[model samples]
Target: MRRSVLGLLALLASTALQAATSVRYCDYPVYPPVSWSDGKQPRGLAPTVVRELFGRLGYRVEMVVLGNWQRCLLDAAEGRVDVVLAYTSAQREQTLRFSKVPVLREEVAVFANRQHPLAFNRLEDLARYRGGLLFGESYGPAFDQFVAQHQNIEWVSSSGQNFGKLIRGRIDFVIQERRTGQLFVEHLPGAGDIVALPPALSVDYLRVAVSRRSPLSAHMAEIDAQLQQMADAGELERWLQESEVTYRDMVRQP
Candidate 1:
């Protein structure tokens, strides 16, 4: 009888452990100052903010740093990863669920070597020039939709490669995010001529994408609400500012 009682208690404990809430997230390792690991741990602007928000919500979060942008999207699409960083474009909206609160504002723009001027007042203006774009990545509706219509744009495997090609004069222009372009420039070896276009294509809101099959779906709305509240109270900006200061301090030190 004692054995039976002990067995039941053990079973209850196991069940409780199984019932503990967990969220699995995925993101590419390349995007620095946003989601990179920085050799020690996941240290970046997005990771810092996200870690704080989810930690406060009492959710056990685990991050899966994937191979590249494409794999991250696939993991989220296949429901293997419970959540992913960044927003869903119109094409991906059909497959994934997005949080209502935006985490960051993404500005996609055209970049060219400063030595050469690539006229880009609007999307239609790019018809004349050969362009390079990140493989398996989208520039929201306007640019992606435009690419679908115009087959002349070359699709490259990585943003670094695209920028490199632009510097080599292999492509007339490349469209990418301003922040991402800055990071790429900082890391790109032997940077020659590269400058961002004065005009931006579109400023899209970036949000956390949730997997529909994950048990965490039920709580995503709550998380989104908390994020919105933080944004309204200027807490998100404050966190970002603090993160920047921390990054600068760390960079300045040994």
Candidate 2:
């Protein structure tokens, strides 16, 4: 009887070890409608889609909403998390593996205080002005290079802070995602004075990046397959719609 019990215990332990694994990812707080934190963990469309995708693959998700975007990337580089659901940049490609199919499309825009209309026709038009950008953010490779070489941009902690600085005349413009900026305009105090300048700066694709050092890096193909299916089924769009409405309600005044 004792021998039989020992064999059964070993079998159960092996089965448990072979069960579905848990995958952890990073999330930037205050990036509403796409990524945000409820002060406890990451919330918004990005986390929603992450949970759905990982759930489909039978993996439990753990969301890490640390300090800021810079902090999140640092953790990713150190292999502290398994994935980062964010916009792709040249620097990120070096340390992480990305799926060819994008997870979401984001429009980058320059927001100016309505009281101070900007005569911005292109990236060059803003050379004289100072802009606020969230820390560790990249609009894309081309614009990022332009900013690096020509533009005067100040890095800050959150998009909300950028908007605040813009209203206070501390910065000339705020570079932010169009949708999230709209949310801030509608939900945040004094944000009503902001307007997104026409002619988007860049149309970016948000993709899930798995850390190269992570064991799950081997599952990129599988992850992409599921992402494609989710896109085909219109799940991503539906989730965006739902997430935006939910977020607005959360921040909107009664």
TM-scores, each model vs. reference: 0.81, 0.89
TM-score of model 1 (CA atoms): 0.81
Candidate 1 residues lying further than 4 Å off, grouped into runs, are: 1-19, 242-254
Give the alpha carbon lDDT tens digit for every residue of 1-254 in model 2: 99999899867644553364888888886778887776567778889988998877777988877778888887887789988877777799888888888978989898999887778888888888889988888887877887888759988898778888898889989888898888877766777778998899889888988888887677777788889999999999999998888887777646
Model 2 spans > 4 angstroms off:
1-20
- Model 1, 112-144: lDDT tens digits are 887777778998999888898755677777777
Estimate the overall C-alpha local distance difference test score of candidate 1: 0.73
Query: Which residue pairs clash within candidate 2?
Result: none
What Cα-based lDDT does every candidate model obtain?
0.73, 0.83
**Candidate 2, position 175, lDDT:** 87
Give the per-residue Cα lDDT of candidate 1 at 19.
66
